[model samples]
Target: MAINPDAVGTTGTPVESSWTSKDSLLYAVGIGAGTTDLAFTTENSMNIAQRAYPTQAVVLGDASGAFANIGTFNPAMLVHGEQAITLHRELPVQGSVVTTGEVTAVWDKGKGAVVEVTSRSVAPDGEPMFDKVMSVFIRGEGGFGGERGPSGSRSMPHEGSTPDLEVTLTTREDQALTYRLSGDRNPLHSDPSFAALAGFDRPILHGLCTYGFTGRALLQGLCEGDPARFRSMEGRFSSPVFPGESLTVRMWRDGAGAARFSTHGGDGRVVLDAGRVTFDPA
Candidate 1:
């Protein structure tokens, strides 16, 4: 009930964030990358140059600071609703950035409220590096009679057509533990007792971890394994995925430089939907 609709347009002070080669390597392995993906998983693999994943931009900066202006709400009742990232250029193995975050929108959905936050990051030289948009749904924070907002259309694969690319990856049982080291350390992804208190039977995987995995598929499948060619990706979190689940990302080419995708968990349920990715086509 403390949700501040007026929080929209409020910006936070710029914060400097930095990361190292080891951080990038850890992120690659956290997202299920392995020896085969040497360029990302190793910094000194005999002639293999280290490169940060395009999606790693999401972790290089912290944007949650702007949430303070959004007013108080039960943290346990909040869940990631949607995520998006745009990379102006490929990330370096070690780099620093200054990020400024803002509250872009707040929508009332009757049963809950959805808040959209955006962060813009710039390299030390003042060059734009990446931008991130994150949406979170807070249960019981709605019904204030505010605007309902636009209900966007879903981006699904062409009817009855097979996916142009399908990459299935299995997450480790300790995936959340590794991903947590990057920045986010939410208890819902690690503490079973806390998860149960949040109505989950057990700990669940971080939505961003799933997003990182899906981004990997898009990079290899559409960008020819080149991070520089990967442009932007956006998707909604439709369901919860437990650790150790197999994720199958099915991508369908939409046009010359665009693709639509959905990720299904091992149970065949769509864990990520309305996915849209754009890259420099090979």
Candidate 2:
């Protein structure tokens, strides 16, 4: 199967769903939030804060099934390459929301097609919540006579100063299985034989799972464990992170409530790079 260039502008049907405090708490736990992260892991704390983890939006914005109707690419050949989210307003702990997505671009990389899907999420009252852009690399499905490379996907400039904050979290061996409950049940993150067929030695962590840990690092190191302080986050996937490995997120404060950051594994390999985070102004 290969990418269908004609599907570039295809739009997915709007999906309406609602989440509760329990769902939010489960998502936090799926991302490895611990007892200390009460705002995310505890409903009582969430009731008082009335906020959801910024990364939780990824779950709500998910358009995985929607892609099936717009592309012919083999699932085994796809890799999540980059992700970005822009928050327009803080998300409530529990609410009804609607999400709609479109295939915005299908640029042709030499080895694969880079497909960009942009989704707009809104509250039931029609309040715009956030915008999400997910970039996927479909191997063996390029050279379709599309644009040669990605556009407007530039990497973030490095943060040269010493990091003012750092947090390291080790993933459990069954991390992917645990995270799958949060709604992304992609076999690439589990199913060893399927991972092997896809050229990975073992199942790799979901890119969003790693994103969740990164968000946790930001919240803990900078936000004082406050979910309300987190406003936005974005990062490019640089390498696959195996479960049970430790990830260290290093962040440099750009100002009071903004920072540039990156994450590397204990092996010193960059896992997520060109990261950025924003918080409600102090």
User: Candidate 2's residue-wise lDDT over 1-282, tens digit each?
Assistant: 667777777888888888888888888888887777676677665445535788888888556545855567677677888888877877778887788888887888867888888899888789998889988888898887778864535554655667788899988888999899889888888999988987899999988999998988888888887766777888899989998889999998887789999999879888899888888765
Prediction 1 global C-alpha lDDT: 0.91
Tens-place lDDT per residue, model 1, 23-57, is: 99999988989988999998888988889899888
What stretches of model 2 exceed 4 Å from their correct place? 44-51, 62-69, 151-156, 159-161
Q: Ten consecutive residues with minimal summed lDDT in candidate 2? A: 150-159
Reference-based lDDT, residue 243, model 1: 93
lDDT of each: 0.91, 0.82
Error (Å) of candidate 1 at residue 196 is 2.0
